[model samples]
Target chain A: MNSASEAQYREQPAKRLRNAAIRRTGSSAFMTLLGKECLELLRSFKLVWVPIVFVVLGIMQPLLSYFMPVLIEKAGNMPEGTVIEMPPPVGSQVLADTLSQFGLMGLLILALAFMGIVSGERNSGASALVLVKPVSHTSYLLSKWVSMMILTWGSLLLGYAAAWYYTWLLIDFVDVGPFMLSYVLFGLWFTFVLTATLLFSTFLRSAAGAAFSSLGVAVLLSMLAGLMPKYMGWSPGALSGLAYQAVTSEVLLPLNSVSWWSIATAVIGIAVLLMGSVVLLKRAPAHD
Target chain B: MTELLQVKGLTKSFGSVHAVKSIDFSIQEGRCVALLGPNGAGKTTTIRMLTGLLAPTSGEVRFHSLARGEDHRSLIGYLPQTPAFHNGMSGMEYVVYSGRLCGLSASDARKRAMELLERVGLASAAKRRVGGYSGGMKQRLGLAQALVHHPKLLVMDEPVSALDPLGRREVLRLLQELKSETTVLFSTHVLHDAEELCDDVVIIRDGEVALQGSLAAIRNEHRRPVIELKLEDAPHAINWAQSFLQKSRTDELRYSWLSEAELQGNRLYMTASHMDVARQGLMEELTEHKVPFSRLEVGYSSLEDLFMKVVSG
Candidate 1:
C-alpha cells in the first residue's frame, strides 16, 4: 500500500503526468463522469420514474381518442334519435397528438429533472470537490449533457413506441418510416430546450430559476413560431410542428427546406448551449 | 526544501469588494503551512484560486514542477470548508469516484480508496451513504478522497472549523500524521490548530496578509514581555492603579518602556518593550506609592495576543 502511494505520486515522469492531466479533458474522463451521472440517475430512481411517466402519457392519447365518442354519448344528455357525427381517428394523427402531449408534459419532466444537474452540485460544493482534480470543465458539462440526452431520448422512445403500438391496435395504421422520423425530430426539439436548461443551470445558482427560465425561453420561441409560421419557421421552435407533420403527412419524410433548417438550427443551438455551459462552469465551478 | 508552489500577486474581486487583494506566498516541498485568519479574511478565496476551483481576477498561481500553461491540478488535492458529497453515494464510492476523476485507473482507484478510507478512520463507515455520516465522518471521507491520488500538495479550506472539540482533535491528529508525508496548506481561524500543526503561518486580515513566517521565527520576532498585576480588591489599591495609568501617559520614559497598559477591575495587564526596565520601573513605583498588591506575574505575550491584535485591527 505504501509503495502504491509512493509510486502513484513519485514514479511517474513529469511530462507524462502533465499529459495525463490534459488528457482528462478527453473521452476517458468524460466516461468516468458519465458513469457517475448514470449511477446517480439509477440511485435516485429517475431512470424509472421519468420513463414510466412518459409511457403513461404516451398510452393516454390513443386510449382517450378511441373512447371519445362513447364517452361523449355516455356523459351528454342527448335526445332520442339524435346522431353525433364524428370523423374517424387516424393512427398517425393520434401519434401526432401524443407528440404534442410530450411537448408539454415530457418537456416539463425533463426540464425539472435536469434543472439541478449543474447548479445543485455547484451550490452544494460537490462540483467544487470534483473540479479540483484533473478533470476538465468540458468533461464535467459534457457528461451531464450526454446523460440528460440519454435519459430524454430513452424515455421518448419508450413512450412514443408505446403510443405507436396502441394507435395501431385501436386507430388506422401509421407508416413505420414517418413514425420514426417524427420521433427523431421531436427528440431534437426536446434536446434543444433541455440544452437551454443545462446552460441556465450552469449560469444561475438556483435550480428553479434555471427550470423556469429555460421553459420560458422555450415558450417564447414556440409562441413566435406559432404566431408567424412563415417568417420564423427556421427557428428550433418549429421542430415540434415539423415532428407532427412528419407523422401525419403521406410524404414519409420531412424533405422541405423549413424542416431541414429547423433541424440544423436545433442541432447547432444545442451545441452552442452545451459550449456555453462548459464556459460558465469553467469560470466558476463552485457557487457561494 | 525546494519550492513546491508560488502564488504571485493573486487577487479576486466580487464587483467593487475585493475578497483577496494581491496576496503573495509560496510553499516549500513537504512543509505544512497554515493560512491563519479570522472570518471574512479571504483565506477561502485564496485556497480556491490555488485549487483552480475559482479563477483569480488577476495574477497567477505558478507550480514549480509544472511548465507554463500545463495543468497544476494533478499535483494538488483540495478539501473545501463544508465538503458536500452526492448524498446518494456511499463513502467508498465517492472516494473511488474522486480518484478516478484524478486520472487513476479502475483498480488503482479502488485500492487507493480503500487504503485512504482506512487511513482516515472511515473504513468501517465506507459502505454507508454519505448522508448518514456525521460531520466528522464526512470530513474524514473528504480527506480520504482528497488524498486518494497521493497528491503532492493537499490544500484544505477550514478543514476543522465546523467540527466539535472532539472532532477537531481527531482531525488535527490525523493531519499531524499526514503532514510529514505530504505538503499541506490548510486555512483556519483557530490559532491553536495552526500553532499545533503548522510549520509556517500566513496570517491574513481583511483580504490582506497581515503577517507570515515560520511559527518559531514569528514568535521570536514579535514576542514582548507582559506583566500582570493582581491587586487586592480594595479602594486604595484601585486608586493607586488609576494613578499609575495617568502617570504612565505623562511620563515619556515610562511610556517608552511600557508599550501598552490596560486595567480591568483589580487586575492590571501591561505589555513592555523590555522586561527588565518595565519590571524595575513597576517595582519602584509600587514601593514609592505604597500600593497594596496581591500578586505580580511576568510572562511574554503569546501568539494568541498577536493574533487578537492583528485580527481585531
Candidate 2:
C-alpha cells in the first residue's frame, strides 16, 4: 500500500509539471482575447440571466395562448348568445406565437448584449490592457462578436426547445418537422441581426450610443421597407418579420421576389456589418 | 550591447497640445532607464507611444529583439499605470490568460503564471479573484502578467505609485531581481524611487528630456557641497556674512534665505559652498557686528533638490 501511494505521488508530480508547462506555452493572442471575453461574460452573469428570463417568457407565451380560452371560461366573461371562435393552439399557431415573441425579443436582447462589448472595455480601462497584448483590434472585436452570437443562439435554442415541449404537452399534438425548420430559419435571422447590432456596438464608443444607434438603424430599415419600393429586395426588416410569416404562412403584399432573396439579403447584411465592425475597430483609438 | 529600443525624434500630439515633442532616447540591452517628470509632463504619453498603444505623430520607435530579431511587439512587455483585469478570473487564471495572449500555449501559460505569482509574492492568493486583491496585489499581478512572457524589454508606467510602503519595497525589490534578465524602462515622478532602482535616469520636462545619464553621473555632475546656517537674531548678519565672504578671497559664494522666523528663537538659514568659508565668514562678520547665532550645518544636495531645480528651472 505504501509503495502504491508513493507511486501515485510520483506520477502526480510529473503530470502536474507537464500540465503547467503546457499552460504556459499554449497562450496565443487570439486565445487570450477569447479567454478574456469569456471571463467578462462570466463576471456579468446578469447578461446571461436577462436572455434566460426572456427565453423563459418565450416558453410561457405558447402555454398562455393555449390556455386563454379556459382561463376566460373560468373567469366567466362570456356573454349570452355570444360566439367566441377560438383558433386551435396546435400546429402553426403555437409555432407562430412562440416564434414572433421569441424572435423579436431575442433580437432586442442580443443587440443590447453586444452594446457594451467595446464601449464597456474602453470605459473600464480594459482596452489598454487588451491593446497592450499581442492581439490586434480585429481579433479583439471578432472574439466579442462571436461570443455574443454563441450566447444569443444558445439562449434562443433553449427557449425554442422549451416552448416546443410545453406546447406538445398542452395540446396533445406535436409537429417536429416544421418546428425544426422554423427554428433554423429563426436562428439564421437572429445571427444576421446580431451581427448588424455588433457592428454598431463596435462603431460607437459608448454603450448608450451603440444601443441607440442600433435601434435607429433597425427602425430606419423598417421605414425604408415601408416607404421605398426599390429597397424591398434587400431590406433586413423583412427578415425579422419573416420568421413569423413562415411559421404562420401569412401572406402580405406582393414584393415580386422569392424567399431566397430575404436569405441572401440577411447574408449580405451580416457580411457588411462584420466588415464594418472590423474597420471601426481598426480605426478606433487604442487608449480612449 | 545592441540597442534594444531606439526612439528617433518621437513626437505625439493630442489636438493642439503636443504631449511628447521630438524626444530622442534609447535603451541598450540589460539597462534600466527611469523616466522622471512632473505631472502632465508627457511621461505616460511617451511610454504609451513606445509600447505601440498610441501611434506617434512624427518619428519612429525601433525595437530590436535578441531572440526574434526586430519585431517590437514580441519583445516588449508593458504595465500600464492603472492595470485592470477581468473581474471574474482568479489571479492565476488572469496571469495565465495574459501569457496565452502573448503567444504561450495553455499549459505553458499556467506554469509561468504559477511561477510568476510565487515570484511576485502572490502565490497564496493565486486562486482568489483579481477583483478581490488589494491595489498593490493587483499591481504585482499586473507585473507578473507582463513578465510571464519573458520579453526582453519591460515598460512600466508609475508601477509603484499606488503601492503602500511595504508593497513599494516588495515591487522595487522584485524589479531589482529582474534587472539582470530584462531591460526595464519605468516612468515615475518619484525621484528617490528612480534613484533607488534605476541604473540610468531621464528627466522629462515640457515634453522633452531635461537630463539623461547614469544616476551616479547625474548626481556627481550636479553635486555641490554646502553648509546651512541658522541664526538666532541676526537678519542683517546673513547679508553681512555674504559680503565678508566675497572680500575674503574664498570661492564665490551664493546665499539664499530658506526661511525667516522667530519660533523658539529668531531662526534664519543661509546656504554657502564650503564649511570653512561659511564658518569663517560668519565668525568674522558676527564678531565685527557683535551679532549672535544658534544653528549652523552642512549637507549635500539630494536627488529631490536636483529634480526640483531642473523641473522648476
Candidate 3:
C-alpha cells in the first residue's frame, strides 16, 4: 500500500501490527493474472459444458460403431428370416473413430469458445484497465493461453478416458501403450489449433474472425495432409493421421522419421504462434 | 514538497491527428491535481500516457524516487473514463485480484480489499457480481481496486462524468475524501468538480496545455470582475440591451472598463477590467435610457470563468 492512503490515515490503530505481519509475500503478477483467468474460465461454464460435450461425443463414438450392423439390419426392409453377417468393429477402430469425432466436433467447440480469449478482453476495455498496471504483457497473454489449454486438455482427457472405458466394456480393449501414444499425438494437434487461435485472437478484433481464421488454418493443414500425406508428412496436420494409426495399432508406434519431423515442427510452430501473439498484443493492448 | 512524477513533452498521435501534443508537467507529492478540459481535449490521452497505458509518440515520463529500472506502473493506480470489470466477478474478488497483481499476498489482498470496499461505500455490494453493479457502483469499485495497492498516485479519467447526478455527487464526495489520503490526478470537463476537489488545475485545449498552476494562484492571476443582468424579456428591454452592447463595443474610452459583453437569450453577461467604472457607467445608462431589468449581480471571476475563457479562446 502507498504510504498515504485510507488504510493508513484511517486505520492507524492497527497499522504497526498489520504492517509487520503483512511483509511482502513475493507473489508475482503472473500468479495473480493466472488466478483471475482460471476464475473466468469456471464462471463462463466452459469448464463444465466443454467436458460434458466431449464426453457425450466420446461415448457416442464407440456405442454407434458397436451397434451399426444391428442398426443396418433392423432398418432395411428384409424378410423375417434374413440374416446380416456383419463383424463387430475392432477396439482400435472404435478408438480411432473417437479420435476423429474429437478432431471435428471438439475442435469446433474449442475454436468457437476460445476465439475471443484475447480479443474480447481488448474489446471490453478489461485489457486497458489491467494492462495499465505493473503486470507484464507476457503474463497477461500467457495466462489466457494457459487457461485455454487447461480447459481444452482437461476436456479431451476426460472424453478420451470415457471412450476408452466404454470401448473396453462393449468392444475389445485397446492396447494401453498404443492408446497413450495416440493421446500425445492427438494432444499435439489440439495444441496447434489452440496456438493458432490465440494468435488470431490477438490479430483480429472480431471474435468470429479469429475463430474462422484459426479453423481455416486447421482445415487447410488437414486437407493438405489428407490429400498428400508423403508431401505434408513433416507438418502438424500429419500428427492427427499418425494419431489414428497409433491408436489402431496393437503395438506401440515405432518412432518413424516423418513422425519425429512432424512432432518437432508442431512444437516449433506452437512456439512461433505464442511469440506472434505476444508481439501482436504488445502493439495494441486494447483497440475498438 | 518533492516532485513525485514528472512528464516531459508527452505526445500521442493517431495517424494525422495528434491526440496529445508535447505536454510537460510534474505532480507534487500529496497534491490533488485536476486535468481540466472540454470533451476531446486529450485529457484521457494524457492520463493514459502517465499510467504507461499509451505509448507516447515523443517525450518521457519519469517517476522520481522510484528504484532504478523499476517499472512505473505499480506506483500509480489508473481508472478509465468508463470503469469496466469482469462481469462474473464479485467486487471483493476484483479488488483482491488487483491487490495481488501489485504483489500482495492472498490474505493481505483479501484484507485490504474488504477495508477499501467499505471506504468506497461498496461494502454492501461486495458479494454481488459486478455485472449487476450500477455505473456509480462500478466507479466506486474501480476506485477500490485502484487503491488496493495503495499507489502513490491515483489517476482517473472522468471518474464521475458518466454517472447520474446522484451517482456523480457520491463519487465526487468519495474523491474529496480520497485526495487527502493519496495524490490524485483526475480529468474532467466539468469545472465544478475540479473547483470542488482539486488543489491544482491544469487546463488543456486542443491537445496542448493552456494553463497550469495552483487553484488559488490560477484563479487570482486570471480573475476579472463580472456583472450579469437578467432582462424582463419585453421587446423594449431587449431592444435597449442590444443597442447598449453595440454602443459599448464602438466607444473605446467611454466603455474602456468593459472588456467584453455577451447576450445569450435574456441574460446579459459583462466582464470588466475596472468594475466600479463600468458599473457606474452602466447604471447611469440604465437610468437615463429607462432600461427595464429583472436581476443584477456583481462578483469576481470564478474558476468557471477562467475555464470558459481558456477553453474557448
Candidate 4:
C-alpha cells in the first residue's frame, strides 16, 4: 500500500475512537443543561432589559455630564458682569458620579436580575430537569455564580471606561492614574456583593422573595449603621460607599479593621448561602 | 429483562399526611408502564422520588446498570404534568438547554435538539417563543426536552392530560414510537390512554397499588362482561327492561345499566358481563316478553371498566 493509504487507515481508527468516546461521555446532558440556562436567561426580558438599560445609562450619564457646562456657557443667559464660577471637570468627579449613579445602581439591578435564577427554576419545575442531568448541584450553582460574576464585572468595566472617555473629552487634561487602582478594588467589592445577593436569591422560592430578602438585609444593615456610629465600620454597605469616596478624592481614611473583617465575613456568607441553596434544591419536592 | 429502575418501599409525608406510602415497584427495560390513579393518589410524589427531587421519608431508589455506574442519576428524563419552562425562550433553545443540563456538549446539544424537535412535531415552531405556544404545542415541547439527551428511562406525569384529542393522539403515537428504544413510565387519570398505549398497567389508589399487571391480566382479573340494549325511549325501555330482567330471574347471569344517550328520536344505550350468559338471558327475555328494541350489542370490558373496578374496589 502507498503511504497515503496507510495514513488514511490510521485516521479512520482515530475517528471511530473519538465517536465512541463522545457516545460514552454523555456530553449531550451537559450541553442540554447549559443551553437551557442560557436560553432561559436570554428569554428573561427583565434580565436582558435591565443590563441594556444600565449600559445605555452608563454611556449617557458621562456624556451628559461632560456637555452640561458647555451647554450652560453657550446659553450666555447670565446677568451682565455676573461670573458663573464652575469647578473644573475632574476624572475623579466624573468617575464618582457615574459609578455611584449608574455603576452602583447597575450592579444592584444585576443582583436583582438574578434573584430568581435558581428559585425560578425551582418554581417552574426546571430543577427536575437540571437534577436529572449528569451535572451536580455544586456545578449548577457555580455556573450561575460564574455567569453573573462575569456579567457584573463586564458591565462595571464598560461603565468605568465610558465615564473616563467622556471626562477626558470635557476636560482637556484628564488624569485617571490616581483612581485606576482604587476603581479595580471597588469593582471587586461590587462583585462580592453581587455574588452574595445571587446566593441569597437561590435560597428563596420566588424572585420577589429573593430580591426583598437581599435588599432587606442591605437596608437593615444600613439602618443599623446610621443608628450606631460603631456599626458603620462593619457594614458591607461600606464597600460601595468607600469605593465612591476613593474615586471622588475625598479624605481617604484607612479602612477600619472591622471593615476588613466584614469583607471576610461577606465571603464566608456567600459561600454558605450558595451551599445552602444547593442543599435546599436537592431537598425541595419536584414540581411535577 | 433487566430492571432499569428499582424503587423499593419509597415513602414521603408532608407533616401529618403521607403523600407516598411505602411504594415498591421496578421498571424493566423496553417496557411501557402506565401508572393509573385518581387525583392525589401519590403518583406525582412517586415520580418526584424517582427523579431525586424529594428524598424519601424512608426507602431506597436505585438505578441499575447505568452507563456511568450507580450514581448516574442524569440518565433519567422526566416530564411533569405542567412542565413550565422559561416562556421567553424559543422551542429550539429550550430543548438544547435541557440537553446541556443532561451533560451534552454545546454542539451536540444543538444537533440533537433539532432532531428531537422534529420528532415531537415542533420543528416549524422551533424559533418561536414558547410563550405563544398552544397548550398542546407546549406539551410537545416539554416532551422534546425530556427526550433531548436520549435518556435511558423517561418518566412522564400525566403527559397527555392537557392535550386536545388530536394532540393526545399525536403524543401517544410519538410515545409508541419511542417505546421501541426507551423505557416509559407515565402516570395518568385517563384509563383509555393507558389501554391504548400501555403494555402494563399499575393502578394506584390511596397511595397504594390497588391492582397491577399486564393490560389483559388486569381486565381479566377485575372486569365482568355485560350486554347493552338501545331503544327509542330510554325511560320507558329501561323501566320495561328492569321489570323483565327481575322477572326472568336467571341466577347464572349478572349485568348492570352502563350509560344512555339521546340521539335524534332514538335512545342509544349499553350494559355489560359474561357474553354467553348475557346472550342467553337477553334472548329468553326478549322472546318470552316479545320486547322490541332498536339495537342489541355485545362488547368486551375495556381498561376503563377494569380501572373503575380496581379503584372503586
**Which window of ten consecutive residues has the lowest lDDT sum in model 2 chain A?**
A250-259
lDDT of 1 by residue, B1-313 (tens): 8999899999999999999999999999999999999999999999999988888999899998887877888888888889999999999999998888877888999999999999889989889999999999999999999998899999999999999999999999999999999999999999998999999999999889999999999999999999999999889999988888887788877567898888998999999988888888889988988888999999999999999998896
Best by TM-score: 1
lDDT of model 1 at position A5: 80
lDDT of 4 at B69: 30
Per-residue lDDT tens digits for candidate 1, residues A1-90, read 998988867856865875665665455678889999999999999999999999999999999999999988998688877798899898
Q: Sorted on lDDT, highest at the top, how do the candidates line up? A: 1, 3, 2, 4
Encode model 3's per-residue lDDT on A52-117: one tens digit a residue. 999999999889988888887879788787877887688899989999999999999999999998
True contacts kept of each: 0.86, 0.67, 0.70, 0.79
In candidate 2, chain A reaches a TM of: 0.77
CA error at residue A136 for candidate 3, angstroms: 1.2
The 10-residue segment of model 1 chain A with minimum total lDDT is A18-27
Q: Which ranges of candidate 2 are over 4 A from the true structure? A: A1-28, A39-51, A77-83, A164-185, A203-205, A226-233, A250-265, A283-288, B66-71, B227-299
lDDT of 2 by residue, B1-313 (tens): 7777778899988899999999998888899999999999999989988887777899988765422333366567888888887768899988888887877777998899999999999999999998899999989988998897898889999999988899899889899998888999999999888988889999999999999989999889887655555555566756555554454434333322221112223443344445466567556656878665666566777778789979988
Question: Which lDDT value does model 4 have at B87?
Answer: 75
Q: State the fnat of model 4.
A: 0.79
The true-versus-predicted C-alpha distance at residue A155 of model 3, in Å, is 1.6
Candidate 3: global Cα-lDDT? Answer: 0.88
